[model samples]
Target: MGPEWIVVGIIAVAVLFGAKKIPDIARNVGRAQG
Candidate 1:
């Protein structure tokens, strides 16, 4: 989609998990895929 949609998705994730945990959540997700 567009850049606007990308930003919205990021915001949604941040809201769902809170800013402090986003990086940790991303790391866990990457490890799971790997």
Candidate 2:
């Protein structure tokens, strides 16, 4: 259930945000994590 929900959430995010901006968003998230 947990992993499936995570996959679904990722798909939802990709659909909502579009593929082009994903890398940049991920980079920003990585920076925030650090």
Candidate 3:
């Protein structure tokens, strides 16, 4: 949709999981899928 929604989604994710853990979790998920 729009950039505002994108940003809101990001903030929601960051709040759900701390910002520091997001990158690590993403990297692990990528590696597992790849």
Candidate 4:
């Protein structure tokens, strides 16, 4: 794979993880409050 593809893959993984974590963090906070 080229360097460009590697960079794209890293960004994709970061985006996916960020998207997944936001909801999970909100849920955890909600549970803590309640």
Candidate 1, overall lDDT? 0.94
Better of 1 and 4 by TM-score: 1
Which segments of candidate 3 are over 4 A away from where they belong? 28-34
- Tens digit of per-residue lDDT, candidate 1, span 1-34: 8899989998999998899999999899899999
- Top-TM-score structure, candidate number: 2
For residues 1-34, write the lDDT of model 2, one tens digit per residue: 7799988987998999998988998999999999
Output the worst ten-in-a-row residue range by lDDT, candidate 2. 1-10
lDDT of 3: 0.91
Model 3 agreement with the true structure over 1-34: per-residue lDDT tens digits: 8899988987998999999999998898799999
Whole-model Cα lDDT of every candidate shown, in order: 0.94, 0.91, 0.91, 0.76
**Superposition TM-score, candidate 3 onto the true structure:** 0.57
Cα error of candidate 1 at position 20, Å: 1.0
Residue-by-residue lDDT tens digits, candidate 4, 1-34: 8899978975786687786676776678799999
Q: What TM-score fits each model?
A: 0.62, 0.82, 0.57, 0.47
After superposing all C-alphas onto the true structure, candidate 1 shows an RMSD in angstroms of: 1.6
**Cα-based lDDT at residue 18, candidate 2:** 100
